[model samples]
Target: MTTPQTPILEARALTRSFGNVRALDGADFDIYPGEVVALIGDNGAGKSTMVKALSGSLALDSGEILFNGSPVDLDSPTAAADLGIETVFQDLALAPHLNAAQNMFLGREKPAKGILGRLGFMDAPTMRKESQAALDMLGATVRSLTDPVGAMSGGQQQAIAIARAVAWAKGVVFLDEPTAALGVVQTRNVLDTIRRVADNGVAVVFISHSMPHVMEVADRVQVLRMGKRVATLEAKKTSMEELVGAMTGATVGATS
Candidate 1:
């Protein structure tokens, strides 16, 4: 029998509110290493709020977040990044004018050696080499690493963005609407890359509205309704109708 793995990240009774609007109401989530979990819900279901809280982009009113089974405060985005957690929002967040390699090492640029390093000169060659390796690992194709990212196709740009996050992430990655507006080929490339990332032993929390894509890539589906997790189901064992029912509260009593 296979042993049950402990969750790499866990959220227990997480609660957040904006005035009278409760964004997260005793919500719960967990993800194991090397697993892909899809977080799904309709509008006002608190998917975005959950992502923000877990990514350390938003503060929680009450509840706890655990990393590797130990309580950890995700006080800020930097704090989450320090814990090897990364989030890729829908916008992609790439600098349009920068090349693939440049964007990958943007804020965390490799410095040059000797006095040049102290003088704030970047180590271009090393950054490019590492960036190329990361992209290659994800099987993401970019026509030119030297060319500006803005000139690349939508799929190519998405690939670069994901590769950058995967390169730096050590534990978990949260991707929000990653395949939203891409063409068929581009979406396929991104979905394939997501699988590769999980295969490499990092937990992936994929937030998407596309049931077909979610069912295609996720090992499990987590359904949220009215700011709480109502059900967690095995993707292969559950159908779209079941997932939609859970999201809409039509299917009750499903939990964890």
Candidate 2:
């Protein structure tokens, strides 16, 4: 549970708004390479808003974002992607008709010559090879990359989505409620995948309200309340009751 040698992503005093909503007021956060930091909060606590700002899907009304300890302007999702930031939102966006390989290589196909460009060129062998490697990295047991993702189990589909991001992106990865809808075994699969990603030197931001899940997988935990970062602690040093109390602003609980 030690912090990384360097922070891959850091947000200092990050503030944003939608008209008078006043979402994410002076929120400060940082994610280190090879670490998974759980982000937890109650409803309307601005968790999604903070994630959007970091993903560059939404801009900060004020404050700053740092990539590799340097200031950065991630104006759009594409901009963030270019800097190796990938988001695995709950809606995976996989084409139900497309097979795992197709979904994994969606939009960012490797360029080659000939009809590969005409209509829709695909280097099938190469794409499948890459997809297989990514899946194997996380121990995904898929019968074939030719199988439609929709035909896969809830856990396998979730693995594919995370693998897709890992295959292409080399920087920070954000999991927005990744395990919310997974069954017990499936949830374990996703949690294992997250550890694998972090072990591979990619920083992971896991946004979840499930305190027990957070306790299980997070190296550290950040509690957000009223759109601000209220507390952060090493996972083992903090108890679930402490986390709950911190999020709820309950006194006579959390250790100082």
Candidate 3:
């Protein structure tokens, strides 16, 4: 088994509140480079809250976020992205009408040099090459880069989304419920792609409810319950029964 390395991202004593509800209560989490860490928990268990906080979509009332062992203030999603943190939420957030390359370079489109650059013309060839390279890195087998993403299968679209994150992410990539509504084949494909993403030396935080999926792909599993990080287990060394017990509080003293 491979040992865990130093964390590329860390959240210490993270706390947040939504009026009467305490969404996050001193939650702590971390992920290391070249590792796939699964963040699993029941609904309302602060999984989403933690992801949002890490991705900079939501600020914590109290906590410290660290990147590469140094403290960071992620005031917004843009701030996070500037620091090489990319998040792919459940929505996928792809431009349905656009092709794979177009969607990949949506807001961060490359501009052509010379006169075209001054005219704000996009560098289509460069974008296509980079987008294809990204997909290839993840072992994605999309039919055509020119085809609209909306026309692709769920698995294909998911590959594109993950590839986009992995392409631009210099530090950490967070994926929320990546295979939530995917079919068996699609889920399998996406899971394979996710592993490839990690193999490329990117720190991946995979959020999901699928036990088998997590077990297959993750190096470690972080269990959150009632807004607190209750346990951290090695995926290959831990059993599903033990994981379930930790999540449900059935095994109160369980630790890994």
Candidate 4:
């Protein structure tokens, strides 16, 4: 894939600290339009911290965030969402009792038209239709829209979470461990959905420790170690050994 000249989202010299631990020490990252960039590292290497900072769920001690080439302050998750940036955390965070459509429109439920709307009646049909459209767009399959998300398979639930994020996100979507704890088929389906999302022109920042999955789906791999970015390599050109070396600090250079 040919990389775009400018990034849709970028971080420069980001730093964050938690008491004695420096979670992010001068970290840098960038993702271009319609690209799937994987962020990988060992535990405590600041992968989570870097994601949190970029998603506007955590504030940094010092750094700069550029959206569409202009500096922007991501003070909260709402701020990030308003800017068309969405994150599907590892937890999935679905309402167990709620159906797929209901869960998708949990906090942003649409009201019915006329007096029923004023009386606090939700537009369930519209929400359900849109939810189906979103899932179809991402090539994600759910057994039924009315079925409770908790009753669905892990992969189905994951698809719903991702589709919800992609439905609202116009520029970038950050997915954390999206294919974790799944069967081989489920993992493959999720990865295919990820590629479809990028095909629709959304930049996907995939965070995963699974090297094989990363190599299969990512166009570029960004490695972080000791709270800083150590290497950025093209997935097609780099091997798993090189990625592991970068994560373990055995290699210390950016190939991309």
Candidate 5:
């Protein structure tokens, strides 16, 4: 029998509510290092809530979160970032006027040394070089780093976003509907970039509704139904029917 590895990121009994509605009810999730875990669910299944909670964008009323076996309080996005957790929301959140490199280092730009650093002068050359390296690491194809993101293609823009997350996250990166409106080729490129991220030893939590994308990119599938993780299935072993059943609660307690 294979021994299970300790999860790099884990959430247990994560509960949250809004007014009279409960968004999450005792949700549990865990992902091992260097693996891509896809989180899937139907509408209002609480997948978004869970992602927000994990990313420190939303607070849980009650629950426990552990990173690398140590308990943590993800009360803010900055707190999560400090702990090596990064998130790429569905919106991509890139600044239109900024170039790819500029967007990548928007808030975390490097400062020049000596008096210039004291004057808040950014080290543009170093930032550009590092940004280029980060994009190159993901094998992302782009015309120029100086070109504004708004001027780039959708695929190129998405690539930069994913690369930015990977460049900063030391433990886990959460991607929400990353390939939602992209073309086939663009989607493929993004998927390939995601795999490269996992290959680099950072755990990935992919939030998406596309079954084919999940099957193609994920090592495991996690089904969330009504704020609970109904089942966790090996991507290769479980069929789309099984995944759908779990999501719809038709096979909640059934073995895959």
Candidate 6:
């Protein structure tokens, strides 16, 4: 396949530091549209810092963020989302008290048409319809639209979170440790959901420590060490041992 000409998201020279301890040291990364790019590394490999900078959770001490070929500043999470970049944290951010539709449309509510077509209420019906459609597109197994997210299984919750992002996202989605704490079946379910998201043409920056999972879904893999990108490789061209070595800096690019 030809390499993408326009990266959906790019971070260059990104740096972050706290009390002299640099969490990110000028890491460079990119995610192309409709591609699943794996971000992998050791415990302090700076993957989290890199993503936080992109997600607007953490401001970069230096460097630049580019979205859709334009240099932009993502100073806050809201700013990022406004530009069509969504993040699905490991927590899933579900409210047990809220049903799936409510959870999906939490902050952004549909406008309700009242007298003279003036907005006066929340459009629950449209929210439900759109939420269900998004979930269906993602192949989620949630049978009841009214079911509380808390009542759903881990896999279902994972799917719902992803589906919600897909419903609202127009550019790129950052997934943090998606398969963490999931059972084998749930893991498979989440992976499948991620695949469906990519199929819809949105870029994916998937953060994970699980090498096998990364290999299964990612088209490209980038390894970070001490906040620096050590290597980038085709998922098919690199093995787990080779990636682990690069991530751990065992022998740099080729596992010498």
- Among these predictions, the greatest TM-score belongs to 4
lDDT tens per residue, model 1, 69-176? 999999898999999999887778899999999999887889999999999998989999999998887667789999999999877888888888888888999989
Worst 10 residues of 3 by lDDT: 247-256
Once superposed on the true structure, which residue ranges of model 1 sit more than 4 Å away at CA? 1-5, 147-153
- Tell me the tens digit of each residue's lDDT in model 3 across 95-136: 999999999998899999999989999999999999999887
How many angstroms is residue 64 displaced in model 1 relative to the true structure, after the best TM-score fit? 0.5
Query: Where does candidate 1 have its weakest 10-residue lDDT segment?
Result: 1-10
Error of 2 at 93 (Å): 3.1
| Candidate 6, 88-187: lDDT as tens digits | 8888878888889998998897777766236457788889999988877765668577988888887778878878877788888888997775677667
Residue pairs in collision within model 5 = none
- What is the alpha-carbon lDDT for the whole of candidate 4? 0.90
TM-score of model 5 relative to the true fold?
0.91
Better of 1 and 4 by lDDT: 4
**Tens digits of lDDT, candidate 2, 1-256:** 5665668898888888888888898888888888899988899888989888999888788999999989999999889999999988878767888899999888788655586657566788888999999988766667669988888877778778878887776899899898876777667777888887888888889998888889889888888888888888789888988888878888322321
Better of 2 and 4 by lDDT: 4
Ranked by lDDT from best down, the candidates are 4, 1, 3, 5, 6, 2
**Which pairs in model 6 have colliding backbones?**
none
What is candidate 3's TM-score against the reference? Answer: 0.90
Which of candidates 2 and 3 reaches a greater TM-score? 3
Off by over 4 Å in 5: 1-4, 151-153, 253-256
Per-residue lDDT of candidate 4, residues 1-256 (tens digit): 5677889999999999999999999999999989999999999999989989999999999999999999999999889988889999988889989999998898799999999999999999999999999888767789999989999988889889988988988899999998886667767777997898888888999999899999999999999889988899999988999999999988775745
Give the winner by lDDT: 2 or 5: 5
Best by lDDT: 4
lDDT of 2: 0.83
Task: Write the residue-wise lDDT of candidate 5 on 66-122 in tens digits.
Answer: 988889999999999998899988778899899888899988989998899999898
